[model samples]
Target: MATTLAEFEAKVLLDQTLSTNHKSIIIPIELQEKEDSLPTNRFNKLFKLLIIYCLVLLVYPVYLGYAIYWHNINSINISWCEGLGFLLVVSTLVYTCLCYSFVLSPLVDHISFDIRFPGSMEKVIQSNEVRCAVSSIIILGCIIFLIIDTQDDRYRLVSAGGILLIILFGFAFSANRKKIVWRHVIWGIFLQIIFGILIMRWDSGRDFINCIGSKVDTFLGFTDSGSSFVFGYLVDQKPFLPTKLENGSLAKLVAEEINNSTAVKNIVVFKALSTVYFFSFLTSMLNYWGILQWFVQKIGWLLQTTIGTTACESLSASANIFLGQATTPFIIKPYLGQLTLSEIHAVMTGGFATIAGTVLAAYISLGVSSAHLLSASMMSAPAALAFAKLFYPEKETSRTKSDKISIKPPSEVNVLDAATQGASSAGLLVVNITAIVIAFIAFMSFINSLFEFFGDQVGIHNLTFDSILGKLFIPLSLSMGVEWNDCEKIAKLIGVKVVLNEFIAYRELGLLIQNEELSPRSAVIATYALCGFANPASIGIQLATLNSLAPQRQADFARVVFRAFISGNAACFLTACIAGTLYNEFTYVQL
Candidate 1:
């Protein structure tokens, strides 16, 4: 054994000497041997190819069914060129996928397998070149199809093209183009379309969504019961109720109408803001019991699997659908320090892209469709991550060590303590919301007055801030499928939501719905577009809140605020696009 070991050491030393002397000759022979022994899984490769083929085959019939049904129902003439363009785009996508899976992937692996230092500049350049090539091919194919298909309806084509232009505009303004992953963008668009089809296009999907919405509405309606108990008739929409008299006689009791009554005091206080407190308290109890966390986790898993974001990012983003932006970071608070800048961007953007469940009751009270609101919140999860990545791509390596999330209960010893704390927190939110609304409304009114005075000199009698905003955002609104006549109106709401807050936008939207100012389809799109907290005010809130959680990352938080705001708006618009595309104006009746 000692002799053999000595012989092995001698041989190793001899080989080292030879390798140093003849580096080029020895390296080439070793590399050739390594290349010959490279691992290849034929079974796995064949199985994946087979699955792709099967999916394509299955989707073809569904596509045909939809096209045939739509054509028959609408009785619209289909041009041969349009049909050909659709086929060509579909074929090109499949061809690209096949080529990448079968050719490019293997070739790249064979060529670059021995390359070390994955983060080296050379590797990054090569990877970017390949990505750019693939993206260019796909984009070129889509552009060709768009040009071919647009030969018939120039107006519709222009609107569609405008939407595409908006997406490109976002990509063009990305902070880190090299870090932007195309897979996230592509999957994000696909997910939005799938959700739109499921919730807006199909009857079964609509039914499911409506049923869930009804439950949400019913749950929110329960808040009225508590409000009525404490605040009497002020919070009751139907204050009058039929009662049984003491003499075994039925009496129809009617409460006096409070709509125009100056005697009615504290109506808005009890009816609007109080409901937020009740819902928040209920949510707190659910969180303490682990119910809310369970649902958040399930949704987070879905996002993690689909978008490939970190567990912390996915959890916080998913939680935003149910909790307020200020409250959601607490779920992943411990891991905040470990999160990358992109992850932080995603968290903030996701928070801004969706409203809290506690406020859902307040919006529902405004007479918006509960189903649309719920769907919008749910869909914003993936949309937020997708757009955030596109705008501010993840450049830093993640430091998170765990995939599992364990949410600590709210800072309370008992369920009762949690409830009380939640109520107090909610009270602060109510005061802030109430004060902001009153102040902003008055501010906007003052601004409009100045605008109106200036417009009077210009001979435009009905000039206002909303009209100015409307003019600015009309192209974007029209691109989202709003009717030309209604584009300005919807644009005003969108502008208000971004410039001010979602509450003001929702208030205006409620008025639009009440007065029938917008078509049902347009209303649905606007509901989705205005469902987020992507206002200028949220930037301060996000910065303050997140900075407190991870003071070490204050610089990162500040850096991403503007990008996060843009990403949040893009997320809402993406959701709006899905809703607009799938929305059948004739079939949809406003609730």
Candidate 2:
């Protein structure tokens, strides 16, 4: 054993191999003493706790004071409560990080397979089945919310079964409870309150963050101006797709409106609308031209400096492998591999809860009302945080030294290289979008056909997959304040989002609005719900992305992807729920 140990230590020192599988060479600690040898900093933990407690002490009182002064409760009161929830979220996150790092990880380090069981508690926690079970709960929550709220019943049984499976799996295989510490939980909440207090107390700091967010958004909008222009132009020129939007009630309405309009003879007005389309084409061409790549990077950097980069798209990361998932988080690459699991989850969830720049034009073209686009984008940011935490409470092994954001600028020998790279990425994006649409549409069509046949034989008229999905999710939609009858319709809309993509879902939403199948509130909720790309495909994308970045941590990356996906999807839904509930509550109060 001594000879083997010496040989392994020597091999690791020589650095001959870097594969994670060669753990014997890479990790020098003897199996028995690994726990004792692991690093621990009581001050860091205590200091973090102190910071959290201080911030919380500072913020909640102001909110309470405001609530009292108003004498009438309003969204501000709800905002305070939500703010508390946010603090709880942060506190839990901090606690999760501390415990995972200080407690669970040491357990993992010391455990050796020499024993009969041959595994650490962390190993138990890391199981795919365990992760999947946890994930299923989060996903089922989303699905349940969708079914109950959207008014669809087609997949009610399936969703219910999924929920049952999640519960059973969770009970049967719980994550290692040995890692948890009561202090961590209390400290997490305390820290959240402290941060909340800081946010509340320093109006200037709070404003600064909001201001930074607003400015970044404003700049993004400006940069996307060309793309938006192109989208509008296409709408004016194409008016309608030949394949989509058949000659039906909606078509007749558009035709009648156009025929009755007198603007056709006015060449000036006609040309103006035509010009908007021209710009839309130009912007769409630019998106494909790689202009957005240049601008998003430039602007992403400016935003990072102001808001702390890892919070969004940091500018200090690598930009290699620009074609695949690697490119998505390249803006925050410097922080990757080093981030605490919570932070990594934050980045992943943000990506999941928000659409990629490649498809922003498509969403715009899909008939999202312009005002709603901004609203959707803004809503997605916070929603990402809410959902990410719920699904994957950060384990202890995940921690980072700082909050610095990082990104890697495009490395090009010349302007042409930059343009070429951008165009290639754009081309690939176009192909990906086109392929996804065709495949998903076909898949849905096949599903509908099979269901239609079965339904017809059974004397059911609306027995499509969507209908079942809608039924299952209707109750959740209602909880979000969607009318009971309208819940199924919205549920189908969300089902489409999960199974296929948000673009199709939004397109369906526009039609629903035209058909008056949704109220204004429902439309708003639907928009929020469908703003993100938190679907199953994204899980594969993130796993591949993170795995490539830290090849050594590939197993860890893969293990967590399921949880990340659930967290991402749930984050978007939670955002929608918050938006829906608040919007409805406010609207009722006004009435």
Candidate 3:
């Protein structure tokens, strides 16, 4: 044994291949097949060319259809502005989807849809069957209550079930499960529920929120003054192009009101997005004047005392209400270095779980009730801290726990300088949003084409990508207390929100509202669910921002960022559950 020990030590010391305490490395390399060299023959070249041709051939014509949809490739002369927008839209959608799917959304460094299990566990059918049976039972219980139970009790039960499932999911993915503090988690859920009761059930609460929403709506409406002054009637009013006009070459397309009493609205997408600049300008002045800082400190204090998060994490989360994700870090910039993994996760999750005040006007312009939107964002702030802590419990002492921080005023010369900076910064956001819409829309077309083709082969019509994803969300929608038949439509909207962004989802929701396809109750629930910025691209966005702020913790951020992304999404879903529970069917939302 002494000789063997000496040999092990000698091998470890002299040879890098051996473990420090063993003669040979104990960790085995995963078994994988070595790949053969690629053939450079004519056949290989031809095969590669064929694939490229097929792919381009398949997705290219969808572009033409998209152009026609946007009134770009019209029956007569194509409008240059619309034509340019179509191209930009397609290109942006493609890039956004590729960037998100390939790079940003991965749970690991390499993108993978994989899991680990033991060989023995694989053979355990009983465990697998038991879980399936239990989930099915819970779903059944929800359905049964839908029929016999009182409306209030039924929705409350479904809401309870949905939250239970979400909490279970948190436990499953928790980083340090044994260290979870239930008090923190419970407060998060309970606080979320309390906000839901206030905004959705209490009459006075709803009225007050609505009053604030009205003020915000009116404030955003002021953008039209600047828009009309700069862009003229084109920005002031919606185009009156009929859908049927695109079908005829003889049709003369004119940008005029159809009649004295037509209901033409904001058809031009750019018009809605223009609000970003004005809101950005306003927020910049507020931040510069230290007004925003005052709000952040008060809100941050409230979140910390109630949720028990570190000062930095709490301040960052609270700052998100009035500030952008990247800017919020500066509010606690001095302490970014001292945050633990759990605290860092909280900060990142807070960013995803809420929208910046800059974009609130853009979202509100999409026909969502201002009251619901504001409530969703406010309710989500505390929920973000709670869920972030739940998924990544504080195993290490947070160095900034006792530290106090305040929002730092922006480094700008004067009011106009701050406004200029804010509006200019919004331009980049506008460009990014446009790109995301275009890229995802084109990708969706390609995916829908594939799905529809396969669905046709199986003799099933209407099997687009959204529809398929909608089916996946059926259980989730049901848990949100949506009606049985209405589940698919709401679920599909949720699907779009997840795969693309909330902006598109809200736009789609607006369309559903105009068509009267979604019920009032489902609309309210969808409003709450679709409130956050928790999508794939946002994972990359948060990482990029936080990585720059704390370069030393990049590896740690990479390990837990995906969990933060999911936690953000779940936090919104929890908010929806609470809304659905207390939703008054008789009371209508002012959309």
* Alpha-carbon lDDT, every model: 0.79, 0.53, 0.77
> What digit string (tens of lDDT, one per residue) describes model 3 on residues 323-438?
86767877777887888888888888888888888888888888888888899888888888888888999999877754555445578999999999999999999888888888
TM-score of each: 0.70, 0.50, 0.70
Q: Over the full model, what C-alpha lDDT does candidate 3 score relative to the true structure?
A: 0.77
Model 1 stretches with alpha carbons more than 4 Å out: 1-163, 237-266, 401-405, 409-411, 457-460, 586-591
Candidate 1 global Cα RMSD: 18.4
Cα displacement (angstroms), candidate 2, residue 198, comes to 18
Who wins the lDDT comparison? 1
Query: Where is model 2 poorest over a 10-residue stretch in terms of lDDT?
Result: 315-324
In Å, residue 466's CA in model 1 sits off its true spot by: 1.6
lDDT of 1 by residue, 1-591 (tens): 999999999999999998787997888899988776654456668888898777776776577668767777988666422463445455666667667867897889788457556577767766868767866776576556446644553443544554466578778998889888876776566566667667876787887677667656766677777788987767764444433323333333222333334244446667867779888999889888776887898788787777667788888888999997998998888888888888888999998999999888888777788888988988888888888888888888887734456777556788998899888999899998888888888988999999999999989998988889989999889888788788989999998998887888987898899999888768888999999999988888889999999999999899888988888998898888766655555566443
